[model samples]
Target: MTEENRLREKVCLLAKSMFDRGLTGGSTGNMSLRLPDGGLLMTPTGASLGRLDPARLARFDAHGKHIGGDKPTKEHPLHTAFYDTRSTAGAVIHLHSCYSVALSTMSGLDPDNFLPPITPYAIMQLGKVRLLPFFRPGDPAMGEAVRGLAGKRSAVMLANHGPVVAAKDVEAAGNAIEELEATARLTLLTRGMNPRLLTEAQIRDVVTTFNVEWDT
Candidate 1:
């Protein structure tokens, strides 16, 4: 099979895995893959992740034009913001995972670094996740918020909404967002229990060892 066809199957497979595992429910997530030629294959606007048909995935040219397939998600601007700002981003995933959204609703979390130092994996996979303020669904302002970060953050928790992650590939993006949700779940589980967080020095070691893009 051609690379594009392989990638199309990969996208559907990963989306179904996440959906089946309850990562996102009832058509509440969107994903996109950056083709080698600089075009994009995005999940349709209202399609359920669990039931995607690879042939029907939305397609866009390098210039951001809708070249084929079903209509792209309204959150296309959100995905494009990362591609425009971060030259290395190859895929973007946005999901309304329950744990992350619950964490976003709580106060006292650091907006600049939303995920706590509860696990090295979160840091390794996600780096520092930004907790952005809530915006109405499909708001163009959400893209503006991501743009304001200047490509420093690979992930952001949309306050009271969901989490968005950009990574070097579709699988990596899926893994990183799952880690984000797991870390959020851990944080909520250990709340007020005085869970021992990884120290700053340890965090630095993880960052240095992984060569994490830890933008302050």
Candidate 2:
């Protein structure tokens, strides 16, 4: 298979796995991966991850213009924000996950940092997940919010909406977003129960060891 075909297959398989496992539901969530040629492969708008057709995925040039397959997701600007700001990101995934959305609705979570340090893995894999204010779906303002971060954050929780994550690759994007959702779920499940989260020193150690981006 050609390299593009391999990326198409990889995206479809990973996206379906996320859907089947109930990470993102029907007609929700979107994904994009930068190709070797600086083009992008993206899920179509209004298409469910569980039903993504590899042959029909959207394609965009490095200039962010659509070049093939299907119409790109309406939130294409949001995906492009990461690429425009972050030098390392090669893939972006946005998910309307239940637990993460629920947590975002709560008033107690920090506006600057969404996920509390619950596990070493969250710290190591996610760095610091930002909590961006809500924007109407498809609003270019959402991209602006991410851009304001200046690409310092790889993961962000869209208040009352979902989480968007940009990673080193498509597979990494999937995994990091999963970790965000799982951590949010755990946070809610153990609320008021005094769960044993990683200590400050522990988190600091993980951040240092992983070269994670912890913005104070």
Q: Model 1, 1-216: lDDT tens per residue?
A: 999999999999999999999999998999999999999999999999999999999999989999999999999999999999999899999999999999999979899899999999999999999999989999999999999999999999999999999999999999999999999999999999999999999999999999998856
Which 10-residue window of candidate 2 scores lowest in summed lDDT? 118-127
lDDT of each: 0.95, 0.92
Clashes of each: 0, 0
Q: Give the TM-score of candidate 1.
A: 0.99
Model 1 RMSD to the real structure?
0.7
lDDT of 1: 0.95
- Ten residues in a row with the worst lDDT in model 1? 207-216
Q: Which regions of candidate 1 deviate over 4 angstroms? A: none
lDDT of 2 by residue, 1-216 (tens): 999999999999999999999998999999999999999999999999999999999998878788899999999999999999999999999999999999999987887778988888777778888898889999999999989999889999999999999999998898899999999999999989988878888887888888998964
| Model 1 steric clash pairs | none
| Model 2 CA lDDT for position 85 | 97
